[model samples]
Target: MTSAPARTERSRTDGPAEPHRRRRMALALAAGGLVLGVGAIVTLAVWNDSEFATGTFGAGSFDLQGSTDGAAFTSDAAAPGKTLTFTLDADTLAPDDVVYAPFAVQLSDTSTNEAAVTIENVIGGTIGDDLTYSLFIEDDFGATCSAATPPAGAEVVADRAADATGTVDVFDLTAAGEPVSLCFVVTAGAIGQGEAGTITWEFAGTSGDTLP
Candidate 1:
């Protein structure tokens, strides 16, 4: 009779605790699933990442021209390994005769640099002290050289230097299609006639980008 009375009421209170524990377990499982979903989305976004870009680079060119009496020859372009040569009009000379050799220097179409004119070589036969020359630069705007005004002196050669290498800073050819003017004065010094000589102008172009 005692054992039958105890077994009757023990089963009823355990029902509510079982359902509460089941609800807490369901909420934890749902939160863990949401966290996993968020992690998957973040992993996908990181896997699909990217970057950007830009351009390229190149080099420049240098070229020049030498002219006498309106005829021009480009350096390294007119002929292979050939320098431009011009003849001076010192064919006839007398004592105290100052001859003006008007000439022009031009930078080629592809030239993008400043240039210098050097007296590279000067040779003569038997002029003695009669054939002396002076180099000058002109500020004339005309394409052809003008003799109306006196030229600005840059270098003077009293006698032919066997190694004549001197530079004259003429007008710079920083822009394209622009040219410079030069002049040489061969003065027959105090000596006898029947003399002849030759002068060579070496125009060397230097890039503006490499200038000091």
Candidate 2:
């Protein structure tokens, strides 16, 4: 008899496409993981550079000294400074009488700049009305300051009454101990009988000394 043909068994090639799709997905996941690892490594890497800076500072000095005699110098930085070694009878002044005194000034060796000196005022005297004075600055070095006369190069600073107020004159001094010599000549102005007192003159000095 004519029997029916036996059914052929299903083969692997004839199965559903699900297994192929799963294999492709696994490969894609593996590639994504590799890319993530490379990105993390790049983020962790770093580069660096730098620089630095720094400074120093200091202060300067200034000091003034005086000499009553032209030889020995000292500081008289207070009111009623060094007493004058007058060449006349200063304690017994009379009409038309004249007296002389010498003084000196310099910047201390420790000073950093040159100086300017001014006659700020004259004070403390009842006899001032009858006393007129003159100040002279001399360029004569190594010579004794004298009341008889200043050096030929001497210049008069002021010829004011002893009680004159305000700035009357100005002078200069070199830096680091160069001395400027001065002579004072005071004259009596019709002084009264038995009228007497003392006077104080102010000598103010400053840095960058100049003359006018």
Q: Pick the candidate with the highest lDDT.
A: 2
Local distance difference test values of all predictions, in order:
0.55, 0.73
Per-residue alpha-carbon lDDT of candidate 1 for residues 49-135, written as tens digits (9 for 90 to 100): 668887787666656765554455445432223432223345666676666666666766775455553444444455633455565
Runs in model 2 with CA error above 4 Å? 1-53, 139-151, 209-212
Model 2, residue pairs in steric clash: 115-209, 116-209
How many clashes (backbone atoms < 3 Å, residues ≥3 apart in a chain or on different chains) does model 2 have?
Answer: 2
Tens digit per residue, CA lDDT, model 2, 1-212: 99999999878886766777888899899999999988888856579988877667665656778887677888877778888877778878888888877778887778776667777646564777888787777665324345455445455565688776777546766667777888777888888887877767667766773222
RMSD of each: 7.9, 4.8
> Candidate 1, residue 108: CA error in Å?
1.8
Clashing pairs in 1: none
How well does each candidate superpose onto the true structure, as a TM-score?
Answer: 0.52, 0.74
Error of 2 at 46 (Å): 6.6
